[model samples]
Target chain A: MPERGLLIVLSGPSGVGKGTVRKAIFESPDNDFEYSVSMTTRQKRPGEVEGVDYYYRTREEFEALIAEGKMLEYAEYVGNYYGTPLDYVNQTLDEGKDVFLEIEVQGAKKVKEQVPDGVFIFLTPPDLTELKSRIVGRGTDQLDVIEKRMEIAKKEIEMMTLYDYAVVNDSVPLAVEKIKQIIKSEHLRVDRVIDSYLKMLKEL
Target chain B: MPERGLLIVLSGPSGVGKGTVRKAIFESPDNDFEYSVSMTTRQKRPGEVEGVDYYYRTREEFEALIAEGKMLEYAEYVGNYYGTPLDYVNQTLDEGKDVFLEIEVQGAKKVKEQVPDGVFIFLTPPDLTELKSRIVGRGTDQLDVIEKRMEIAKKEIEMMTLYDYAVVNDSVPLAVEKIKQIIKSEHLRVDRVIDSYLKMLKEL
Candidate 1:
């Protein structure tokens, strides 16, 4: 059987541009990994293509998958169920193709509990101040709400300790470049590739 | 003090083209790391420049440095002492510049003992047959010598388990690319870059 592929997770504090960077990586022509399209029970937005943006599922269908233990990680947001499908991820990985997941910090933590070996990357802002400005720039929140978000963002930044990498999203291309390098290097990591050499040595 | 730079070591079995890959890397204008030129007690060879090729030293001077614990790792071969100078490596790394070392397996092991956190990369031949062919292609060894060299190569290949990455020397360019990725990713590892984020969080 071909070697299993990496489960690469990109996640971090809110407004860290994790989605932008993940989109940039996928938009790149040389991307070889499969994007793990999420499943959600929410209504589809305008121009959102099925299986492209998300796999829109009925509430019953989503809950059934969750009950069957087929959701890699799932979370309810405003009564909408959103999650990665365990079956899709495992099938793609089993086929020797990497599965990319751009998730929230809490969802990433759940993924970590289930797949400890996944390459968990934390895309951080240049600093806390930059993160605050990004959140403030959203302009939809009141001052108190922004402060509350800054507090939550501070807590999420602390979760960087749980990740395998902390990439500063100073620029989309630069962050994408670093993430690509991380994936390439992870494939060459000894723990992941040494078994073949060990077997080769035994044969020799 | 600035963050300490990574100690990147490239090593592998004999005739695995470690020197070729290293030369390719250094020749690239984008290469950022400093190559740790070795110091040796051997007589200067024809057309070999001191410091660029090696830091030529007398036996007495080499011994003096060794006695003073100035060598990062050293070995004796053909009545000559060859070793990496400890001061230069530490000084470069202290200045927040990476130091790259391309050495043999034994010297790599010694460097590992001293710098366990260093990024150690083992370059392996595609397979035993390819390794044997490469050794035989040297055209200087008798059958018995070739056999003995193969045995030694086998043992060195087994030492790959000690490394952080194993790069197959299938093609020099491919191997160089992988090494470049490894270095880039190594710089992003959480353990290496997390301190700054932790400090940022504390201030926040």
Candidate 2:
């Protein structure tokens, strides 16, 4: 049997540097994993590509996939449908490629329900004070939005208990290394390895 | 608040290099975590220290701890009691140190029940043929004992589904690196870091 691939879910509060860590993991030469490019109904920006950035789709097509249960998990944000395509993820794993899904807490929960054995990783900032500073440093949002995001971040923090593991994204390289380790370690699970051996022994 | 340490449980079939991987983790300069030395009624062999290798205890003492529910889990092996001491693990975590327990599948399961949030990692061999070779290559066991161990190993493999993560010990150094990464990543759990910040904001 072909070696099975792992479904790794990455979630963290805003300003935890998950995006930077994901980029690092992708850039690593040692990693051969595939990042799941999600499909969305939102219009692509000037620099975005259809498949690379996202599988940009019409609202009708997005809703149809959801209706057919083809989407692993989807959410409507500002009237745009954003979701993971189940077929693409399954196809990647079938090819013995690990799949990485960077998602929010709600989407992660949904993915877990559908794929019970998927690895769920929660990323966090080094500490609260540092997180607040990072958020303030971004200078993107209005003061009111930053305050709201922080409030929502609190609720998300409580959900960490639900994750399979938590990785602190204190440094980008360190966080990426941790993600690689988790994936490598997960490949050693006996459930997938020992069965073949037992069968071989019986044949012997 | 002091960062909380994770309760990590590592288990796998024999010959999967779980011990070697753990040794690598301990040897690494980045890992300051404490390994939980088990308490046992088994007689200490040559070169084994009481507190360092294991908490060597009398049968009566072992029974006393088990009766008081102080032992996290225990089992009788070769007429000797083998189990984990609860206080040391808790004390280590309370001091902001991660605790690692090298246990068998049964003991790992029991620890998981008691510590629901404990990280359960199962070490696996690269393949069945490699596993068989490793078991036979050990050269310490008699043919019969090796056969029985192999049989038991098969049974243990079936329990892999109970574990939270599977790490294959293909190479000792690589396996250890993966484990270290898992530990580092877990520290960044969003709930802990984000909640700390939210609490700080509330105080303000």
Candidate 3:
């Protein structure tokens, strides 16, 4: 039997380019991990698929999943509920595909508490200056906007202590390469290795 | 300041081509790891440098290191002493180079007790059939040799649980790729990441 896939939670502060790194890593069809599609109450925007982008659910349908304790971690933003569906993650892992959850630091810790097997990774910027540049690169010069982001970045950086790994987003390609290596190496972890070898050799 | 290097203990059963895998990974100059030059009382063979191949030492000097508790792991085979020096490993790591110690499973456990921070990796063969083929591939048909080696392989395979990671040596190049990935991923471990970012960001 094939080994079950890893549950990976990739998180970072804003302006760390988490989405860009994710897109780059998954750009190739050969990548084996499964990107988690979140369940949301928000209406679908243009060019969004039903299940591919988000599992859209009505208020009752979403509440039913919460009552069933299937939501790994959920929060309401702007009167819309959004959460990770635990069953989908388990199903994907059962299919032998590593699951990737792109989340904020707080959600990462919350998901980690629920699924301790998840590998929590923090993507850090090279420095505060680089982070500020990336934040402003999104197109803005407002003083308060940059200051507020810098403040949030400080708190999120401290949350890295709870993570299992930290990779600097020095270059998008390099960061993606490091993440790929991490996922590959994690498959070689002793506990994660299949017991078939032991069983086969022990009979000798 | 640069990050401190990892101390890696790579062990495997006989006929697993551990040495071949090691050489392939370190063949590239870009690899930052250092191979440990062992101290031994054995006579230097041709093409072996004093410190490069082995730190040639007299029997009395080798005993002194053993008595001083300076040898990380040592064994007296054929009236010749062979052992790893703790000081050399520390000096290389202090110079920001990862140290690789290719030893047996027993020596790995012994060294791990002294340096608990060391990363232990076990290399397993593809299967017992592959192992037997590799052993026979060495052009030895002696029943006693094959039987003795098979017995030892079974024992060492059982000890794999003591390792942090296990890579299957299905092919030399692929095994080397897996080992390289393991080393690269290890550097991203949370505890090893420097707090420079934290201190710098908090001052904002």
Best by lDDT: 1
Clashing residue pairs in candidate 2, if any?
A: A166-B185, A166-B186, A167-B185, A167-B188, A168-B188, A185-B167, A188-B167, A188-B168
DockQ of each: 0.48, 0.30, 0.47
Per-residue CA lDDT of model 1 for A1-204, tens digit only, reads 668899999998878898899989999999999999999999999999999999999999999999999999999999999999999999999999999999998899999999999999999877553563555667677888867866776676679888998888887899999999999999988888766555644544
Worst lDDT 10-window in candidate 1 chain A? A195-204
Per-residue accuracy of model 1 over B76-184 as CA lDDT, tens digit each:
9999999999999999999999999999889999999999999999998776435645557778778898778667766765697899998988889899989999998
lDDT of 3 by residue, B1-204 (tens): 445688998888766787787778779667778999889999999999988889999999989989999999988888998889989998888887899998876788899889887888999877643554644556657878877767766676678878989888888888878888898898888877646556555444
User: Chain A in model 1: its TM-score?
Assistant: 0.85
In model 3 chain B, where is the ten-residue run with the lowest total lDDT? Answer: B128-137
TM-score for each of the candidates: 0.85, 0.70, 0.86
Instruction: Flag the better candidate by lDDT, 1 or 3.
Output: 1
Candidate 3 on A1-204: residue-level lDDT in tens?
A: 456778999998877899998889889566889899889999999999999889999989999999999998888989999889999999999888899998877678899898887788899876643554544556656878877877776676677888988998888989888888898898888877636556545544
The residue-by-residue lDDT of candidate 2 on A38-111, one tens digit each, is 89999899999989989999999988899899999989889899999999999988887889999877899899
The C-alpha lDDT values of all candidates are 0.88, 0.78, 0.82
